[model samples]
Target: MFEYISSLWSQFLSLLSSFNISSALDVLLVSFIIFSGIKLIRETRAEQLVKGIILLLGIWIVANIFSMNMMKTILSYFFNFSVIALLIIFQPEIRRALEQMGRNNFGKKLGLLNKEEEKQKEKKQRCISAVVDSAAYLQERKTGALMVIERETKLGDIINTGTVVDAIPSQQLICNIFFNKAPLHDGAMVIRDGMVYAAGCILPLTKSNKVSLELGTRHRAAIGMSENSDAVIVIVSEETGQISMALNGVLTRNYTRETLQNALEEYLSSSSEPKTQKKIPSFRKAKKS
Candidate 1:
């Protein structure tokens, strides 16, 4: 038994010796792609699909080792055919992932160059302040409002869906638009670069059944928008006068004025956003869980 262990160790050392820096980088690249794909589909219907595939693979491995020839053949054929089926089944998810990739800055900061970063930071702070103040005012009046603040992802598609306001963001403007009797009260308002860029925009509704039935259209739309883009969505409950923010498919509730302000600042700021974006590792996912 000791000799057998010694032989195994020798083979492991040989394998390690055969690997170079290029092999290490190759593994890292593959790992990053897998991680990014999982992150794109996290908390969506596609996550369940991935989980099912993992279970099937586990069963196939067991069946193959047990000499279950019929089961192995069936499983092999299923996997081979499922490639096309998965593409069809997950078409929406695939499109969304590709769209998100196109939206990213190619792992490079195009808009956030270090030279002008300080100026941009000040602007981002002002934007966060305006949004938080407006949200607080809306929350106080129970004036139902849904606002999407664009971050790294360009929301040109979403912006074109609404009436272009192109006015500076202000507490009064936000409160007035969300008033029950206002013209655009039924739709969402979008803020970009500290400006009320658009209003009366339509956002997609979340298809996941995991959301609570108690959450209304505003919250559903917020979640849906967050799922589609890397935007921070603020929602004020008309019925309960509660404030909530949705990001990356997660809905957080019961935010006070100060807490909400801090959250927006932390999330909207260039530095804080990177912490959330670095989900390319299992350790980070485990930490979040």
Candidate 2:
């Protein structure tokens, strides 16, 4: 045992002596790429698929170690064509990652704000106020509502799924759209560039098991939409009158009128105006799904 340990130590020291700056840089780059790929698949269905693939790989290794010819052959054939299979299974995740890479954040990075940009900021501020007011009204009456505010990623495809109503947002208009008796109340409303771009739009449902089962279709849809794009989704419960927001696959709840406005402004505004770092309370209670 001591001789074996000495041999392993000698090999380790030899490996360390051979390592250089280029090897260090190569290792770092590979590590960063792996980390980025994992982060890209983190909260989506792809995460589970990845785990399944890793398990299969481990089993294949074990089969090889045991010289199980039949098992090794089957696993080898599966892995031989795994590249194409993986592409088909991960198509949505790949598309979303590419879109995120190409998303237009250059202006924000360069801090460029022209006259038209300033006007757009004003419009978004007004829209935020109207949305908060309508959410407050709906929460009081226990009327369910789902409003999606588009950000860097364009939601043109999603907007096409619903009836277009390109009008400036207003508290009364928003409330009427989500009224229980209204025709569009059952679907989602898409707010684009400070205007009500569409209503009655259908959103993809979340497939993640991480979400609480108590959440309803609206909350799941909100989380799903957030997972697919860089949008902020506001939801008001029909039964409990609780307000919630879904962003980047995380749902935060218990937002009052003032805090809701503050949160929206912090997310949507591009102005240089300083704002308070008010902490919006998180999801405090279990919700129905």
Candidate 3:
């Protein structure tokens, strides 16, 4: 056994010495492919299938070493067929991986793309300003309103429940929706990709103990929806005529128009940094009278 091991090591060294740069690169590329495949399998239920394949390969290796011709031939065919079978079985995951690769490439090129993004962001800021201004105006007139601002997470599920508007946001349009007898006044309005996507949308209601009793259904619903998503919700109280904002399940109350505008700008600015800082004071943590 020792002599056999020494002979195998000598043969391996001889093969290594004979390898060209192209062969070395091919080996490195294959190593990376194997590593990535293992990682992908580990991340998904496909690991079980991989284990089965590995076991089959191991059996084949042992069979070939032992001169079991029939077993070697059968296993080789199974192994060859598995490559095509895996492509079909993991099609969705493969597509997602390719999409993620494309997104990463796009992100790397973002410096060149940022000018266009900035223009779109400028447009969005104007829309946000309009929404905030509309909410403030509505608050003064005691017009109840619910405005949902989309973030990283898609609000497609919520948007599907409401009437699709797809209109450019304006103060007049928002005010009209929440007017005394507007048909869509009863439900929330959803904004997505700088457009009002839907109206009269029913949002989930928040059940946070931290939420104040002074807050009505609109505020609770706003907090609820925001908690479930990465959305920013602006609520105008019909009874108290106050402006409030809800994010990540927390509500901030008594926002002046300027404060609201600044909060939106700070939160919505195109910075890629993760937001850990609170944009507004928590309603529960307000100073005692």
Give me the runs in candidate 3 sitting further than 4 Å from their true place. Answer: 1-115, 272-289
Q: Is candidate 1 or candidate 3 better by TM-score?
A: 1
- TM-scores, one per candidate: 0.72, 0.82, 0.58
Runs with alpha carbons beyond 4 Å of true place in candidate 1: 1-19, 31-43, 51-82, 92-119, 272-289
Each prediction's whole-model lDDT (CA):
0.80, 0.85, 0.77
The best candidate by lDDT is 2
Model 1, residue pairs in steric clash:
none
lDDT, residue 121, candidate 3: 85
**Quality of model 3 by C-alpha lDDT:** 0.77
Query: Tens digits of per-residue lDDT for model 2 on 1-289?
Result: 9999999999999999999999999999999989988887775678889999999999999999999899999999999999999999999888777766776556676877789988998899899999999999999999999999998788888888899999989999999999999998899999998999999999998777777877899999998898788788999998899999887666878888887887788777742212331111124432333
- Among these predicted structures, which one has the highest TM-score? 2
- Give candidate 2's error at residue 228 in angstroms: 1.0
Model 2 misplacement above 4 A = 1-25, 41-47, 270-289
For candidate 3, the C-alpha RMSD (Å) to the true structure equals 9.8
Give one digit per residue, the lDDT tens place, for model 3 in 1-289: 9999999999999998999999989999999988876655553446666678778889999999999999999988877888798898777446535533442334534555478787878778877888988988998898889999887667888988889999998999889888979889999999887888899999988645556777789988998786566688988889988888887556777788778887787766643423553422246321222
Clashes of each: 0, 4, 0
